[model samples]
Target: MPTRALCWFRRDLRLDDHAPLSQALINHDEIHCVFVFDTTILDALPRQDRRVEFIWHAVAELKETLRQQGSDLIVEHGDPATLIPRLAHRLGAHAVYCAEDYEPAARQRDTRVAETLKQAGIAFHALKDQVIFAKDEILTAAGRPYTVFTPYKNAWLARLHPRDYATWESKTLVSRLARHDDTLVMPSLDQLGFGDTDLCTLRLPLGTSGAETLLKDFLERMDDYAQTRDFPGIKGVSYLSPHLRFGTLSIRRLVKHALEHGGDGASTWLSELIWREFYQQLLWHFPHAATTSFKPEYRDLAFENDTARFEAWREGATGYPIVDAAMRQLKRSGWMHNRLRMIVASFLVKDLLIDWRWGERHFAELLLDFDLAANNGGWQWAASTGCDAQPYFRIFNPVTQSERFDPEGHFIRRYVPELATLDKRAIHAPWKAKVLPAGFTLGRDYPFPIVDHAAQREKALALFGKREG
Candidate 1:
């Protein structure tokens, strides 16, 4: 057993159900907890990034929780590849442990850190903490990685045991954490070269307490999730994606609840969680999908990459009410309803014929809950270039999606307030409304549709066909 170990928190921010933290506690006599605001990643982001703000507050809360238990987090700002090994060496820790990160860059950085630690005769360990099933944990009967989701989910469900979702209760051993001076202080957001975001106004509570609050609320609404999940205007889905992304909530706790409840709502919610896991495994197995389409045949697919249309889409001036409203939601709140995400993604790829990478990168910059694997999977799915993607011919009609999912335009009105006075029918497609709302004029109050959906649908189909054929 190691005499001293450093527990490095990354994506898994909480104190509970954490394997690395628990392993450190079980194997070492003294544990030093640290979180690095990795400058390598932060240096490229805009100072006003919501993700940075969320992480800053979340880590702050984690530190406070530790302090209450006679331990404090060592918060540092530097590149993890360099800083982690140096910190471990300085502290004379026998080993360094961290939550496993599977993204390409993170994987590379972890490898470098591990090598550096090895050079100093210190061991490095990474454990599965964030996901219920990781790597090839849920493989097919043939012992191959499952590419498609339903089969993967079926295997996942079959293989899942009580042990899979068991809690680690790492905090029960919190006494083992290395004690720190009361004077030790964490850096402020300004000190980290980041500014404030609208996270508070958006009511995105930070940290473990916030995640518990969301989980409680979501359980009450879980019964309606299956029926209501696709409706943008309704409060149908659990708004816990950010918490899940940052590991504020344990996958075990969530899955155990759903499996035990055994209802359509819980079951459906579980499937969504499964979808998150599926994307993760896909990225783990096919890291190239991070930057290119999963299907190699579609890798060089021609896209117009229309700059003007993409700019309009980004600015929420697409003239398609649903797409515009969704874009507005993304810009304002750093989140878009899941249904809206699909609709807007289709509009960007099929209608504007823009490269899906553009929208994926845009979302990466804006979403508070952005996960590279999930974002890439979602964008590729919409563009019909990923595993189990939408049929190439089945392009989403933005107006119809608006009518079906947001008929009352309540969601639209909230984001596109300019369309508030228009009748619900007109709100979705103002140009086609027999009589425009009394005060509104096309191209003045709102811009005209950038492109005809039908024409663009044909163009997109032909473009993809040319490449795929």
Candidate 2:
């Protein structure tokens, strides 16, 4: 039998720019690709999860890609620890290779899988393909993780070299793909106890093709990214976060594009990508941040538990136009603009005095691009509970935010269509409009602002004060 290697596909779903796949091809004559629909993870998600559907579709596409290359992906539905080793044993593969996963749960799962493979006398090799820089690659002078982003980013830039962005060229190894005597089968979504979700409604294309489309589109508008990214109303931002989250797009390719041809906009966009890396490292260094505040001093900070208010906020009836619009957008698309994400997060924790974890949990449930590191980083940053967070006193005025970012209320109108008839001036604050639309009333139609922003701001400040005391 030819020496066989198992290429276990994780987040890095695509065939191109894949380090593990390239490495597997380099060292082995026959490469068997596999993807496990991890039940340990899927069991916790809602049946209608868009993320599940997205992954399923991406996997389907990848399997097809492999099939075109005269190979088939072996799809399994079970715990990865059990499934990976079992599959490797059955295939009698010499080694198992995969891309590294950074999330706490993922790290744990990978560890267990590696141990199982080791016990079975199979070498497990994990390559860094997800993020450009990971785990102590960019550190402070004293060899500690940098809590702040700027210095870390600067160091990351300084450490950057031409070869860092070079492609792994997996295409050269396509000939090494294992061909089975009989056709390998892919598990149906229902076999995994998952129902068909209307993910197509979101219009998010799946797999490498989708990533390429979004990247190409973003490159055209890369120059204006900095200028227009702040405005939620404009089509200035790249909708590549979901792609990045799934590793459908390679980070190196993205960084290379931004550096080589991307102008000012690309530079700004690249920094955002670096921020993602910073957060990933943060989570890796401090796994406690998953449950507790990154800044320990803020962990005991009081949060008001107003379920009614939180419900109103979640349902986009908070009466703050920008906040409402953003909430509605999240509900509809399972995605939100980065600027608006900060605004809504701040509104929940600072303005409403709610716990940041509550908002974080909600985002994790709803966001298609939900990665624990970036999600936690963003929420903590907004809540003033993370390293390099905004000061507690720096609460966003939702009305002012609406006026600045959604000046024409285009984003607002798109999500909150009930306020579409209102003029631009009144759009941000429909409750304050003297002459309400023919059949509109604050309490009846839109609902009043759940709590007075000024009152809640003071309450949040005092709560933090008490915690400090």
Candidate 3:
């Protein structure tokens, strides 16, 4: 009897460089590809979510690519824990293969799926494709996971042999993809309970082809990534976050390119890629941080959940130009600059004195590039509540950050156009301008600063001091 396998596509959407997909092609005589809409996640999302739309388009592209190679993707709707088992039993598959997911909920879902498959006498194989190193792969000499980033990065570097970054070369053997016995058509966005958003109008690329377009363009400017990545006005950054989040591109290939480049820019960019892995392992080790503060001591520190102030921050009306611009960028587009992400997050936690979880949840709903681990880790870092977080006293001065990274206010002017007429000097702190520009009323045109930075800093210190001490 010939062995048949089902390749379940989750975060790893592309066919090339996918470890589980590659392994399935070799071990089985026939392969059936699948992607689940996963109503468990989709049912709770807004009707006009960009993430659902992005996944829909990416799955469609993958299906077309598979169709060209003699097979069709089995795109299914509903809960995967129940549906995957039924599909495998119906197809009489010997085993199911998929990429590993580290999130708590995903792990639970995978466990259920595995149990179901096992009960039916079918095997389940999950391969690591998202991260270069994950879950204690880069442990300390004592065999414990490194809590700090420097040591973790150092250990990660020591363990990164050439084989670790080698391409899987999966595409060449995709001829083994099993042809679909039934003619099953993929459903449209409306069928999935999602509506069209600015994703198409924004002209963001979709699937493998889209990732290649971004990678090629980024390589031309890789040398300048160090000096330019901080500025959000121009296209200094490689707009590949969404691609990485959705796994349209291979993490192994990305790391290999950075390793080969051998420059400060590439090394810095490589560190960022490692940081993504670092956060993943962090979540895997300390799942409590997903909801509570990583440092338990910080959890007792009361965080004010100010409703009106958080709304102002969300709407980009906090009266801080840099912070407002970053929020506006996130609201208008489904993305925000990384540097601005830090700045705005600091303003929210330290200046506005709000809970980091609230900000993290808002970003979860809005950011197309949002990964639960990365988003939660970043919010905790900004709020001084996670492992390896910034010192609680070292609050970011939003005005200074704006003046330094976005000098001449190009980024601010682009996103917060109400401050466009203000000169560079006044743009950073428009309220402190010696003279207001004509018709630029402080409260009427733009609201005054929501919270005084100096006062808020003192209040934040006192709050932490009273509880943390």
Candidate 4:
């Protein structure tokens, strides 16, 4: 009759370097690991969600891993507040352990689960695992969370220690996993009310294996990351955002690898990770940023919500090839290059005079790597509505962006097939081609520019001006 403990798995999916899992193995002789599909979240998602498919595949892999260890993952599809406490009571476990989540909905869910566990006389323990430093860890001298990124990044670098990069050894404690008389059955995606998503067909190979594959591939090209990351046509960027979002890879190991072997590429990549942490902390300190701008000054900025323009943008019919290509890529794959994300977001808020929140919500629904903090921070940054944001007047010229980043138009051609035949010089602005290539018409083949970029820039400036004055 060893003391029983339930380790609740959330975003930190892997068994390695998991604080809650490690602690469970250390303290409890018999540890039962469980994952709830979380209906509260799933019910709100679209039917063909790739993110959900990714999660389903990841969970299946996790169960297989546990089975190989002579144990099994107890999978449930319901609200954790009800399911966790009920399962703990059924197992007669004394405590439940998990990693902390900072998102508003997740925070609320955890609080509810904690209260239910408390009433049931079971201890609920949560540990920091997702991030190296979180909450108020790198606050200003006056004890406030820093609004700007540079100072916060400097403090984060200064605070880094060897111990922080060390992995928590859960492999040594594998024998502690709970063995039940009856093995628990895991549910299928259909049972959870989710249909087969595109992710399944893509065969992205979820869980630890997928993370490792992407990591190894990225390491091979890491030295040239800075040179290649900006160009969407090339494999310049590491396609690890989805893995990071799902916690398939350990952040400590990523940082350690970059620091030891990555040179200048590692330096730039590490700064990007720090930016991620900064956004997470920003959300923690200012949850209001989810609904409104971070800089209160830009809250009242006017947006001319033209649904026609937004539809054009979403359908990848925007005459600006780079912006259109990025949007199209997002539609096809749940992932987008970081550079493209910035470009598309800037086009939405600055060029179209659309509200940043609208674009933010759309991305949240579509992006597999959509974390609230990063998504919101990115949208506001593009719209010049956040602290340390780009100036409102410095709107991106989509043609120039295409010329500079996708010089050969290879990326644009891949996604926007209508522009495939056009040469490099004309691909950026197909609408302005002197001779309309046979069967290529602005309204017929590819839609015309939704709104004139130059005219809209002036309109956006005036809108911000009115708000400031």
Residue-by-residue lDDT tens digits, candidate 4, 332-436: 888888888889989998888889988999899999888999999998888999977878888889989899999999999899998788888888888787876
Instruction: Give per-residue lDDT, candidate 2, residue 308.
Output: 85
In the range 328-416, model 3's lDDT, one tens digit per residue, is 99999899999999999999999888999889999999999999999998999999999999878889999999999988899989988
Q: Estimate each model's TM-score.
A: 0.98, 0.98, 0.99, 0.97
> Which residue pairs show collisions in model 3?
none
lDDT of 3 at 302: 76
Candidate 3's TM-score: 0.99
RMSD in Å for all candidates: 1.2, 1.3, 1.0, 1.3
- Enumerate residue pairs that collide in model 1: none
lDDT for predicted candidate 1 compared with the true structure: 0.91
Ranking by lDDT: 3, 1, 2, 4
Better structure of 1 and 3 per lDDT: 3
| Models ranked on TM-score | 3, 1, 2, 4
Off by over 4 Å in 4: none
Model 3 score (lDDT): 0.92
Model 3: lDDT of residue 432: 95
Q: Write the per-residue lDDT of candidate 2 for residues 179-258, one digit (tens) a residue.
A: 86678788777777778776797788778999999888988899899999999988899999988988898898999899
**Selected candidate, larger lDDT, 3 vs 4:** 3
Model 4 TM-score? 0.97
Instruction: Indicate the worst ten consecutive residues by lDDT in candidate 4.
Output: 197-206
Which candidate leads the pack in lDDT?
3
Off by over 4 Å in 1: none
> Residue 6 of model 4: what lDDT?
97
